[model samples]
Target: MIKTPSLREHIPKTFADIPETTAYEAGYLVTKNAGWRNVRPVIDKDKCIGCLQCYLYCPEGVIAKDGGKVKIDYDFCKGCGICKKMCKPDAIRMEAEKH
Candidate 1:
């Protein structure tokens, strides 16, 4: 059976402990195929219960909690539909990214 880290093991205890990523935001970053995604996830605020299932499952760590709402950072998101699949309330939807 596959094993996953527990919530306590996954989340950082403090902001200082958060892992840093320079590849996502660094010089010449705009040239890193920033807008190449054909699809992206959008969260429906009305339906979102802030369950954070999406945030927990996001491999890129681009999803964050803001004002008790779940926010997706499209900049680092790879158009993966994991968030939508994990959302029990069906709050997240994958829509075509508009050029």
Candidate 2:
């Protein structure tokens, strides 16, 4: 799991609220740039064919197999769109991040 700032300290109002980052948060390329992302990936389970393309292409280690389905960990996903582009079945799509 992504080790984000403790919510018990003071809840982050948005992704931009949390600043400190470790490589464990996202990937090296995106760990400190989470707020810079304008979009986020969301997967359509029915459209997914269990190809694992998203899981393999995801750089943030946020994609995983859960009950034979691809689960996306938004806590660490940097919205880089690698998974969306790698999805042959068009299962994943990037949506505008709502602040």
Candidate 3:
């Protein structure tokens, strides 16, 4: 009879011991290359009320307070969609980044 490995035995002891990339990682790379574009937060100046809500909620620090309105740094943004979700005025919208 075949036996399945226990969950405890399947986990790695240390982070370094784990493989550099897993199958999921490879799949993500494939999807990313195949136009699985990331979402970037775009702030509509007219809709934005200069509340800094997006800047405060962005965990990635991609949102910055510029003068009074908020601006997103697309280069560092991971497209987590948090900023858009947290916007009180719905000023932020997630748009697909062009590759």
Candidate 4:
């Protein structure tokens, strides 16, 4: 059986627990940057083919496989549309952030 690590396991316990990263890096580490997002990606599960294209192209590495489907971790997602663009099935779409 394939074992997947729970998202909780990756949460940082404190400020010191956050991994050090360079500004040049494309993604954030366990930090909730949703406040900075102007748009967010919403996945249509029914249209998803589970091809992993979105997962592979997500620059923030926020896309994950969930039971043969794909999910985006909005906390770290920077609202980039790479996932939606890479989604061949048109499963992902970007919408304006409500807040």
Candidate 5:
């Protein structure tokens, strides 16, 4: 049996305060808002070694291999900071998006 982490394990308890109905209705709203204001991963091309480590480690599938560099999809990036943490060459850095 493959084990998958629970949503509650990843989402903070504060999110539970949202009523189920509102939560359902606001899911897209939340995602849209996150895209507008959440921190985004910026790749320093010169620092990247073309190792593809960030592409393999992003949980949100935000990182994409672009030729010899990596690109981040801000629309889907949740700012989890995992890519920054996993980059072997320390090429990825998190920067807050201007709201």
Candidate 6:
């Protein structure tokens, strides 16, 4: 039902400066907001065990350690649920977005 461009279309036979490939083509860092996901991660302080698993596995780098507790940054989180599944202590849970 979906169609994607071919790999050859994205890569060139020779090296040259292309405008379309400029974004992250040469190991550059880019930050973009991904807060449009349908769900979000919420951390429970009481249930957290301070293992830091969620922080290490977060793909968006939205999880962090505050003193000894884990905190989630909703602005950049894409709600992929990697943190929720990686949290062995069951501290993080994925809930539907309020809006």
Candidate with the greatest lDDT versus the true structure: 4
Best by TM-score: 4
Candidate 1, position 67, lDDT: 62
Q: lDDT of candidate 6?
A: 0.70
**C-alpha lDDT values of all predictions:** 0.74, 0.73, 0.64, 0.75, 0.66, 0.70
lDDT of 1 by residue, 1-99 (tens): 899878889776754454443124433345434377888999999999876788778887777766667787676688879989899999988899779
Clashing pairs in 1: none
Candidate 2 lDDT by residue in tens digits, 1-99: 988887676965653443333124344444444676789998888998876767766787777665566787676678899998999989888999999
Ranking by lDDT: 4, 1, 2, 6, 5, 3
Pairs of colliding residues, candidate 6: none
Return the candidate ranking by TM-score, descending: 4, 1, 6, 2, 5, 3
1-98, model 4: which lDDT tens digit per residue? 99999999999675345433212243435456668999999999999987777776778777766677767777778897998889888988899998
How high is each candidate's TM-score? 0.67, 0.64, 0.59, 0.69, 0.61, 0.65
RMSD of each: 7.3, 13.3, 12.3, 11.6, 12.1, 13.1
State the TM-score for model 6: 0.65
Estimate, for each residue in 43-72, the C-alpha lDDT of model 3 and write its tens digit: 889898876666667775556555556676
Stretches of candidate 4 above 4 Å error?
1-30
Summarize candidate 5's per-residue lDDT along 24-58 as a digit string, tens digits: 22235444534444687788999988666666667
TM-score of 5: 0.61
Which digits, one per residue and each the tens of the lDDT, describe model 6 over residues 1-99? 899999878874432322222122222335556647899888889999877777777776666556567677666778999988998889888889877
By the TM-score metric, which is better: model 3 or model 5? 5
As for candidate 5, its clashing pairs are: none
Candidate 5: regions farther than 4 A off: 1-33
Candidate 5 has an lDDT of 0.66
